[model samples]
Target chain A: MKLTIRKDQLNDAIQQVSKASSSRPAIPILGGIKFDVTHQGVTLTASDTDISIQSFIPVENGEFVIAKVERPGSVVLPAKFFVEIVKKLPSDEIEIEVKDHHQTSIRSGSTDIQMVGLDPEEFPVLPTIEESESITVPGDLIKSMIRQTVFAASTSEQTPILTGALWNLSEGQLKFVATDRHRLASRTATVQAENDYKFSNIVISGKTLNELSKLVADDNSEVEIVVTANQVLFKMGNMLFYSRILDGTYPDTSKIIPQNFKTELVLHTKKLMDAIDRAYLMSREEKTNIVRLITQEDGTIEISSSSTELGRVTEQLEVKEFKGESLRIAFNSKYMLDALKVIDSEYLFIGFTGAMSPIIIKPTDHPHSLHLILPYRTTG
Target chain B: MKLTIRKDQLNDAIQQVSKASSSRPAIPILGGIKFDVTHQGVTLTASDTDISIQSFIPVENGEFVIAKVERPGSVVLPAKFFVEIVKKLPSDEIEIEVKDHHQTSIRSGSTDIQMVGLDPEEFPVLPTIEESESITVPGDLIKSMIRQTVFAASTSEQTPILTGALWNLSEGQLKFVATDRHRLASRTATVQAENDYKFSNIVISGKTLNELSKLVADDNSEVEIVVTANQVLFKMGNMLFYSRILDGTYPDTSKIIPQNFKTELVLHTKKLMDAIDRAYLMSREEKTNIVRLITQEDGTIEISSSSTELGRVTEQLEVKEFKGESLRIAFNSKYMLDALKVIDSEYLFIGFTGAMSPIIIKPTDHPHSLHLILPYRTTG
Candidate 1:
């Protein structure tokens, strides 16, 4: 296999596929990135059993000349070192030649690097998924959805399904919900779809979604997501992201969300987040991460937390708007802060259904995003 | 104690003094920052036994209004939490009041944080050094000298004195030298001194110098260096940095640096450094970190490194100038790279005594800085 490619193009392709490569793989070939060169262009693929990514660089596309092919062949090289070498190469163009016995030579400028390449036959093939049911969504919206809900997913593996975010599409509205039992976050967006196809239980690992989010372009580019029986594929530009769906049912978090509230408080998002963040420092020391919020009769909220070793912090914020009855509630400050950060609005509306029930938070302008945090029982 | 200080001023003072506060201090009070508020200004001090730093914020200094003293008193507050609180405070000016029972209340905007303060009497006093024998030097020069020589200090604690850089002053010239047996780096500079005072065998820990380098202002401000029986104090601007001297005799490294060389190579510092850096990646994986350099008869040099698992890399760079005889030598690429990084010149002149003797590298423009790296005996 022999190919000449632009350094920047090759670096970008390697970075895209290298995300799927594992530092310590169960199979040695999983740690390698497969380079398939053909007359059309070159395709780089990497996989770690759970997540696989493939990036293609066409020989010539309009104004961009990505690569030039001399011979059609394939080989697998150690992803870690190859990526580093490609990034640090001096010349604008790099020439890679693979001789017999999988001996590869990379030359750029005055440097010549010979790397041992593994046989391409040993590397795993990309998983094939049917593109029968696919939904197209804006890359920017999907990235925002992933960022809003992925952090709420449980990191613990005790219940493996909880470590993934549920992707449900119904009636042309795609929803992403993630919960670790303590708190829950959900984001909904309108996606273009043909017919009334519904995907109810497509739960993808939060880790995979986080990686996919990074690949999503910030522009309003369309991303085609194809869901199969066991695998899901996201196609954007010349990149294909594939991940296996979790094998379990996601909990029915909709039932836990409170529909009614005893009190509702509207305040500036940044102000509330800052106050809770400071209170969290004290509560974090106590390990409980519990911060109390008390609503006064004068339409003001008091945020405070105390630790035996670290004294206490008290902050008062004037509510912009208040409704119903005044109430006091205690919840994990980290959960509140996390929920507040994802709300892209100036003002936040928080609804509490009694002190023991779950509290719902939503941006005043963005009703499509919802966050719920369960209150902690406090003796006070 | 009651005082109102600007958030930026308090934050800077806390950051400066907090460097001396250790996370796990031997004495609990040592982890706290002592605040002495007088009619003139407030002095913030922190000590970790080996090193102590104090920063003063004056009440009124022309355009810089650092702090205002409402009442005069002293107290020591936990450095970690106080710094964090000050950074996150909302208002521009923070009001701190120390009540009875060592309780401190810090108010900023609508937030109030109360922290438990330790007794100021329990904190260690700053070491007093007579300024009669002090030398004033530009802060920028001392910072540069520290960066050029500190990395060569031995990290292993087997010989405690080797972990410190030897500071020698003679005839208005200040010299700093550090070596880890295999490699040595020395830097010399002319400084203004009173009389013909000479200081020798004064070794300061490389770690302390590195910390002091961070506190050094980037401008041409003068820094006063005061040396005593067992301590060295660096006074820059309104900050005083005190560090304890290492106790031991530094080995004479002058004899190892050969005056005459069998080979001399002058090339672009960046070009050679880049070639060696690439070779070092392969050698680093082999656990030898040895890169071979061979001077050809045509006045060009070949750099290469090979590993059984990672194959090999070979690069040839054209030498701008070469003298003496052609020679081949192998050395640790990391040491050479470290030395090249600190050279403030585009071209570097390397002097080799022999294949086995130490090689000296110096910038063509800078004669005050010198770097020496020992050769590795390669089987090939």
Candidate 2:
């Protein structure tokens, strides 16, 4: 196999695939990235059994040539070392050729690197889903939706299903829900899909989904999502991302969300977040990282935290508006902070169901972003 | 204690002194900074037995003022937590007060914090030194002198003396030397001092010296270095830095530097350094991280590295001039890179003495910075 490609283009493609290449793999061949050269373009594939990433660089469109294939063949080379060499190459274009016994030689400028190559047939082929039930969504929406809910997913693997966000689709709208049992966040968006298509029960590993989310950009590009019984594929631009799905069912979090509240308050989101953050310094040393909130009759809210070893901190937040009777509530400052960061609105509405029940925090403007957090027990 | 200092000024002072405060200290009181409020100003001091830093914020000179001092007293507060709180405080001016029992209250904006403080008597006192044996030098020159030699010090404690830099002064001239026994770096400069006074054979820990160097800037300000039997003090505008001297005799490295060479070459420092850096990508997996240099008759140098398991890389560098016959040599690329980074000259002269002896590198324009690296045995 022989091919000539621009050093810059090859460097970018190599970096993307190297993210999935494991230095130490259960199977020795899994440490390499399979490179295939054809008349159309060059394709690179890398995987670690759990997550697989493949990127393709196509040939010239009109005036500029991206890559030229002298002979169509395939070989697997060491991923990490190959990427490093390509990134540091001193020339504008690089030429790669494969000889007998899978020996590969790369020439760029005055530097020539002769790397040991493995048989491409020995590398595992990542499973691709059949083109039966596929959903196409805007790349920007998926990226934003992932960022909004992925942080709420459980990082623990004891219950693997909870470690992944659940994607449910119905009536041309897609919803993502993530919860670690203490707090839950859900985001919804509309997408064009087949009229008869419906998906609700499939659950992907939250870790794998989170990794996939980072690869997508917030743009107008369209991405196709294809799902099989045990595999999921995301096709974005020139890249293909595949991950294995979790085997168990996700827990039902619908009942945990509160439907009514005794008090509701509307305040500037940024102001409240900063105030809570300052209070957090003192709360970190205390048990439960608890911060108390007291609503006064004059429509003011006071945030306070104390530690026996350190000291105490108190701050009064000026509320823009308030409803219902005056009351006091306590909750984990970190959880509330996380819930507040996802709110896209300038103003947020926080509803309390008493001192011990779960509190609902929703965007005062955008209704799709919902956050529910459990409150910590407080003493006088 | 009372003060109304600007948030930014207080933040900078806290940051500078906190460098001497370690979390895990032998004396618990050493983990806190002592703040003494006098009629003149407020002085902050932090010490960790080996080094001490004191910064003064006068009442009339700085950007902010120590607004009031109802009662003059001193108290020691936790270093890490206090710095964090002050950095994130929401107000321009912070109000601080101390109670009779060492309980301190800090208020800024709507945020109020009351932290537990310790008695100031428990804090360690900084070392006292007179100014009779003092030398004055430009802050920029001292900082540059430290940077050029400190990198060659041994990071390991196998030979404790190798971890300190030898400072020798005589007849208005000062020299700094550091080595790990494998490579050596030396820098020298002229300073203003008494004609009859001379200081020689003083060794200071590389770690402590590096920390003190950071406080000096590349400006025309003068810094006074006071040397005593057991300690060294640096007095700047309003800050005083004290460091304990290393308790060992430094080895004489003057005899190790070669006075004659078989071959020499002059080249642009940056161009040769870039070539050496590219060679590192191929040599990182090898035992010695060795890179071979070949000087040819055509004034071109070849830098290359090869690994038995990986591959090989060869790069060519153009030299301005060459003397003597063609030669081939191999050395550790990391050590060469470290030495090259310290040279301030645009052009550098490299001298080789046989293949097994140490190679010398010096700036073509500046005579202050000099480095010597030992060659590695290469059989390939």
Candidate 3:
């Protein structure tokens, strides 16, 4: 296909779709980005076997005109080389043309690059789902939800379903939950949907979940998520992000979430994060990276950790309010730090069932974000 | 031993010396930094056998007074843990105390760290060099000279001497030369030395060369270079850097640098660099990353390169001056780019002897920096 496009716009489009371009593709044609041009604009598509991305650039916005289109066709040029050449092409406008034998030529300023292209017929076609089963959610909310819960997904390859984040919808609430079986993160938000869908669930691979998050903007823009039997598509702005749904069943995490707790404490989020981070420098050498939390009689939470091979560190923090008796518990500092970072609230309330039980952390101001961590067994 | 110091000062000192400490060491005590406390000040030393760095923080500028030191002594604390703890300490001032059993305690704000330490007697001590063999030069000029020439040194361990930068002196003029036998770089400047001190030579390893460069400031600070038979010491401001000299003869590179050439061209450094960089993106897939240059009779230079597996790129560069007959040559673009970045000049003059001869690049304004690159054989 022949097209001329602005450097910045083309760069953004290329980067967005490049996430799906396979570096080591099982099929040779999957390594390239397919370019399809029509009278309206040019569409760029890239896909691995599991995920696919597509972007479109309109004709008017292009810096230079795609002149003398004797024919309209599609071809696949090397994605990486073409992108790099365009980025460093030294000029504001670029001209691209495809010949009869798929010989692609790109010219910008004083530089000219000619590359052999592959026939577009060999590229795989991405499947598109119907819009009937789709739900609309704010793009910023979707991006925040993914970032808040995706890190908890299991990276271990033993259980494939655990490597995916479970998305569930019921009534008017949408919930995102991910657990590596050690620690679980769940975020719930209200979204717009038609015809009260009943307990529909889709488990998306953690990688695709993260990549789809980047495609969403932090503005008030809305994105439509269309779910089919085995595929899901996220349409945001001018980009389309598609990923294959995980096949296995996800474990039910509802029963493990604590409903009753004897002790609860409220602490400033930044203060707790800073205390844990300071303690982290010392405890990081240990495998568990465990840090002990002690609620004092005077309403102070003391954080302490030690490694026999490295050293010991203790930090004291002030809590806003405390109930029940003084208690001490130990948990992975990294998990606590990660959970604390996504809370988005100034203050957090932590609920403890017992020293040996999982501790639940929730924002005091906003209850939408919830984080749970399993305590580590310590001699103290 | 007991003392208190400012967290920022302690952190800076530790970071400076920590560069000399490696995670793996031949001796156990070598993995730690030796802290010596006295009524005057506190000194910290770290070494990885080959190089050693020391920084002293006097009591006057320190945050806290040297508390009850019933006895003055020294002990070695694990360098990695100590540095991290100091950097993340919560308080403005950190208190450190070492027990007779070699256990050290550090307290800052509400955080306390205790670590196991080693006997300072077991650590290898750096030998003090006599002051008579020292040559003083401006720190900024020395740092620039090192940066300009050190990159040309061979990185391979097979030829140990070639991995070092050669220092030669004649009539109070100091010159640094480095080469991998393919390309050579040399920088010369005047230094303060006795008139009778005609000549001396030393070769410092590239690893140490890089560390020494960091120690020197870019400001007009004075630095002393003290040379011993086995080791060379660089005194910059309050920091002391000592490195073992490479024990071998350096190859002479003066004869290889071309004094006169049949063709000469002067071009803008930035423009030439950008063109070469663009050509690099196309030729990177090739074995040598080779780019060819053809000086046309019409006063423009044609740059081009191609990869059998990738693609081809061609660019034209307008020249300000062309003094000789038209010529064509090919060279590794990366080497030229490196030389271009280090030369502190707006305009660069390139001297070409023939199609397959070594090309010399020098600054039109500054005569101190020189870069020589060997030509690559191009197939017709």
Highest-lDDT candidate: 1
Location of the lowest summed lDDT over 10 successive residues in candidate 1 chain A: A125-134
Compose the digit string of candidate 2's lDDT tens values, residues B1-380.
Answer: 76666677678888888889977877668889899988787789999988999998776665545445556678898897899889888887888888878999999998989989989989998877866778999998888888999999999998888898999898888999999999999999989988867888788999998998888755759999999999999988888888898888898899989988899999899878877877887788786789999986677999998887667778878888798868889999999999988888999999998788999999999788889999988775
For the predicted complex of model 2, DockQ is: 0.65
- What DockQ do you compute for every candidate structure? 0.77, 0.65, 0.67
The B-chain TM-score of model 2 reads 0.95
Off by over 4 Å in 2: A218-220, A378-380, B62-68, B194-197, B218-220, B295-299
Q: Give the better candidate number (1 or 2) by DockQ.
A: 1
Interface root-mean-square deviation, each candidate: 1.1, 1.6, 1.7
TM-score of chain B of each: 0.97, 0.95, 0.95
Task: Summarize candidate 1's per-residue lDDT along B101-213 as a digit string, tens digits.
Answer: 78999999999999888889888978878767888899889999999999999999999999999999999999999999999999999999888988999999999999999
Using DockQ as the measure, what is the rank order of every candidate, best first? 1, 3, 2
Interface RMSD of 1: 1.1
Question: Judged by TM-score, which candidate is best?
Answer: 1
In terms of TM-score, how similar is model 1 to the real structure? 0.98
Mark the regions of model 3 whose C-alpha exceeds 4 Å error after superposition.
A61-71, A195-199, A218-220, A294-302, A325-328, A378-380, B62-71, B192-199, B218-220
RMSD of 3: 2.7
CA lDDT for candidate 2 = 0.86
Query: Which candidate, 1 or 3, has the higher lDDT?
Result: 1
* Top DockQ prediction, candidate number: 1
- Give the runs in model 1 whose Cα sits over 4 Å from its true position: B63-66
